[model samples]
Target: MIFRQIKLPPMLGYLLIGMAIGPHALGVIPSSEEASHLAEFGVVFLMFTLGLEFNLAKLSAMRHIVLGLGLAQVLSMLALVGSAALLLGLSWQVGLALGAAMAMSSTAMVSKLLTDRNELQTPHGQNAFGILLFQDLAVVPFLIMIPVLGQPAEQLTSSLGFAALKIIVVLTLLLWLGQKLMRPWFNLVARQHSSELFMLNILLITLGIAWLTELAGLSLALGAFLAGMLIAETEYRYQVEDDIRPFRDLLLGLFFVIVGMNLNFAILLDQWPLICVLVLILGPIKVMIITALARLFGNSAGAAWRTGFALGQGGEFAFVLLALAAGEQIIPPAINQSTVAAIIVSMLITPFLIQHSDKLVLRLASSEWMNLATNLHQIAVRSMANTGHVILCGYGRSGQSLGRILHSEHINFFALDLDPEKVREAGAAGESVVYGDAAKREVLIAAGLMRARALIVTYAETHSAMKILEMVHQIRPELPVIVRTQDDSDIDLLKNAGAAEVVAEIMEGSLMLASHTMMLLGVPLNKVVRRIREVREARYQLIRGFYRGTHEESDESDRQQPRLHSVQLTQNAHAIGYQIGELGLNELHIEVRSIRRKNQPSIQPDEQFQLQNGDVIVLLGVPENLAAAEMLLLQGNR
Candidate 1:
């Protein structure tokens, strides 16, 4: 919870907590086979989830990165690290196991960090994920191969051949036969309409397959993965994944904890120098290999560096492989301790390294600086003519909706989005959107922030919204900025940060639900409207005086609740040639908040501003008084 509160992955906290309480430290929890066995299910479920999410369409799209770049990265790392292990005086078997383990980078950590940084759509981010996908697939073979390598020297080749044949036979049967039966079986389960039964059936299938593989002298995780792949072919895949997620996450966390519990600080301390050496070598060597491979694969130097930096750390799967090697006595105790320690250290430092990656890239590659400038230049070019336009911080669904509405209203808008695909598709449709990070001051400036009439943050991510808000506050303090939030939790925080209005979706959704319920229940429409108005008036300052109260209310003050009405001036309108001050609207308890002119930007008119024909004046007052104000403006003294 603390880690999540601080926006860090809970897996890190799990590891640290496990290390503290395990036998090597305070010994609050004794190390035991039972706990380890229970924790291994986490790995099983993780593999299952991976298989469930796997799809041919996605794989085919990323074939080059996955096959070409990913294959190169794994092979290069294995060869490099294996050679290094030999130099350290380890046996060939141990070296091979170590190579496979070190070749893996943390999928959980890198992917989570990339998403949080909103870089998942960047070129480097895509490359990193593609490579990580291959690494995940590679774990299956390593799981099978490690035990074979641990066999006696004379038996190793035969054992490997036998394992390969077993894997092929088992996989073929499960995938082929299971696909035929899976859909019908799922259909039967769905017809029952019992969630409990459905959940039980899913559990049965996953564990039953896992048990089969274990009985066949293969890893239990291998069977679970196979089970997932079979189910993925059926329409029930998403339902199965949803039902299995809690179990997967819980087990995965426990698995990480068990990994932490296995750490022998005494052994780690004894091998401190070697541990340090491995940690120092592991990250830099992996980074260099991945960077070189990425560049060779036709990526920019900037993208290559980012991908390398992102995947340089050891992964959660590395721990799994290391444990397997240790169990088979393939790696000595001292080497296992040092390698695990080094990997943990690498994982711990990965977030910081990734966070500073762009800066590091700019420093290391001159081309990166040029790339950033070019991006900003493109954004500037898009927004150069858009004075008094609305700057949209995100171009997702919410931003897209706002962009369409703005466009329909003849309001110019420039949107910045990180998702390259979204930008491309939306731009092809002639949207006034571009690919940029609105959180950066330069991007905001290039989006015409200084000339913008209003800015709206459509995404509900508070971290990104806050950054944009901070930059906007610094650059354009007077600009009216509206922020969207998921709930009321951050409403005050955003409002205090200079937002003109903070729209909480939850609050708005609840209000809408309440209004619909009231109307459906036969409550008077006027009463429902007044109830919604009261709620809005209390929550939003800008909305406080915009809605008129019900006239049937007993209290005079209730009837006098303010309302908003917009009146378009005709050529013969009495107020067409008059300055706002000369209209004497104040005497009628009316206020002109803004005036929208055709083919021109809306403005908050001052006293000296003269009204023009076809101007839509937004007026605020009681309904009765607003009627008089409209008559006075449209005709003359009425």
Candidate 2:
């Protein structure tokens, strides 16, 4: 049953199952060092995938939040824990170890949860990701500090500094060389079109880089993450991700299972009172403090609570640090064991806490302080909203071109894009672009759909587009909507769902085909398909004007406009060997539009024209005069 649902999140179930079979219960899997080794692979692959998805541009843009907020959280948590450990009369080294362990949050678990809930693109998610990024980076520094901080300072300082220097050198070299070299290598591999070879190369690169980082005294996970970032820049990134995902998932699943198997119920039972205190008292207190700090940094009340709730559990990395410190005799075996039990329990309860965070926040918001916070956040959002706008969903090629045109026309438009980097870049350029999912009503609301004059959905999967249209109709039925779809089959559905205009993809493709086919079939070069396009545009405009009640039935001025006209060439033609200008065609009240040769429009034509057999002349004039010109031009050609 569990294997059948492998695609589902197996972590929670695995944890519960592990608890049932752990040492104090059925004793199926012992609390052995081998269990720890098995669990480490999960961490490795989790880090590898995280690296694969890491967007360097976004990291650069959010560096302040990543560095500042992340560092503050770490330092503040460390300070509070260090004080508590001292109050408990633990040794200074043990105090430091405990502080370091408690300072971190579970990047793997939180990210997985966020991804599952589809909250990873939200503002809070970005902030949480930034913090996690810094924490991942902090692993190197923490490893260096462990040996020195746990031991007598005088003896370990020089070694610690040397280790730190080596790590810095390796990281710098990897970032520089990886960014410069990996893309071309991947591109070369991609051209070979061997899936097995590509998969092999991806594994080698991920493991090789992780080993290199480990050899440099940094975590293997960090190295794998960096390798992923390098590959992310390659054109073959998606393929690489697809190839490596199975291995990553299997290893990560094994890792979580091992983490669960490590639950030593005996130790947990011995320290049940302390463990409960940590889970109940310390957990909520830590969350509250973190929430307050996050709010201070301008996060919404909801965002702050989410940030706090997500970090409530002690991180997986904390166990790593604690184990390392225990080996160094810095923290006692009992303290380490108790901390592990407390961490596991906290982690097991965390998902439920986060799942219920919305209700928790809503209840909290009923309070005076929270109400004030919510009001302040609402004010900030309102102040950011500017008017006279068009909201464009999707920023793909066509959408981008439209945005440029809108900019040139000095139109006020805001773009909503799923791609975070594009959204960030567009915003940086002083465009009102937002990172959001167009399919979701909340995301649409965030993009100011209600305030806009028009909504344009330029790029989306069909289902997503349909959902957006449905949401638009439900929210503001009268709002003008334009949608672009790649299939003609969706046109009727889009229209029925309240799209004012559906630019069918097939229509555009057919038009392109017709123009190219005519050119290939020897359409006159001077006009070719231009006159056809113009007439179509004019007809469309006329129809639109009529629909808008702007074109009256009595309007003769529109009727006087020239229409598209064409005639087939015949064996006899009086105009043969005569230049179009010399033919006195204007006196005949006729205009040459194009000429078709060999059953096709000749793209190249000359004013000094000679009629040929099977050539077709297209003309524009009054209906009667055009007939006269057609008869004269085709008299001899046929």
Measured by lDDT, the strongest candidate is 1
**RMSD (CA, Å), each prediction:** 9.0, 16.5
Backbone collision tally, model 2: 21
Candidate 1 whole-model C-alpha lDDT, 0 to 1: 0.86
Question: Taking the tens digit of each residue's C-alpha lDDT, what string does model 1 give over 1-638?
Answer: 99888766788788888899999999999989999999989989988888897788988999999989998988897887788878878788888898899889989889888877778888999999999989999999998998888788899889989999999999899888998899999999999999999999988998999999999899988888888988998888888999899999998899888888888988988899988878876788789889999999999999999999999989888988998899889999888978988998898888889888878999988998898999999999999999989999898999999899999978899999988889999999988999998888889999998888889999888777877877875666546778999998987677666666789999999999999999999999988988888988888766766554455554676667776666778779999899999989999988887675643444668999998877768777888989999999999875
Candidate 1, superposed: residue stretches over 4 Å from native: 507-538, 548-638
RMSD of 1: 9.0
lDDT per residue (tens digit) for residues 223-340 in model 2 = 7877887888778778878878788777666665555665666776788776776665348877887787788788877778888888787876776677667656787665676777
**Shift in Å, residue 210, candidate 2:** 3.8
lDDT score, residue 603, model 1?
66
Question: What TM-score quantifies how close candidate 1 is to the native fold?
Answer: 0.83
Sliding window of 10 residues with minimal summed lDDT for model 1: 545-554
Backbone collision count in every prediction? 1, 21
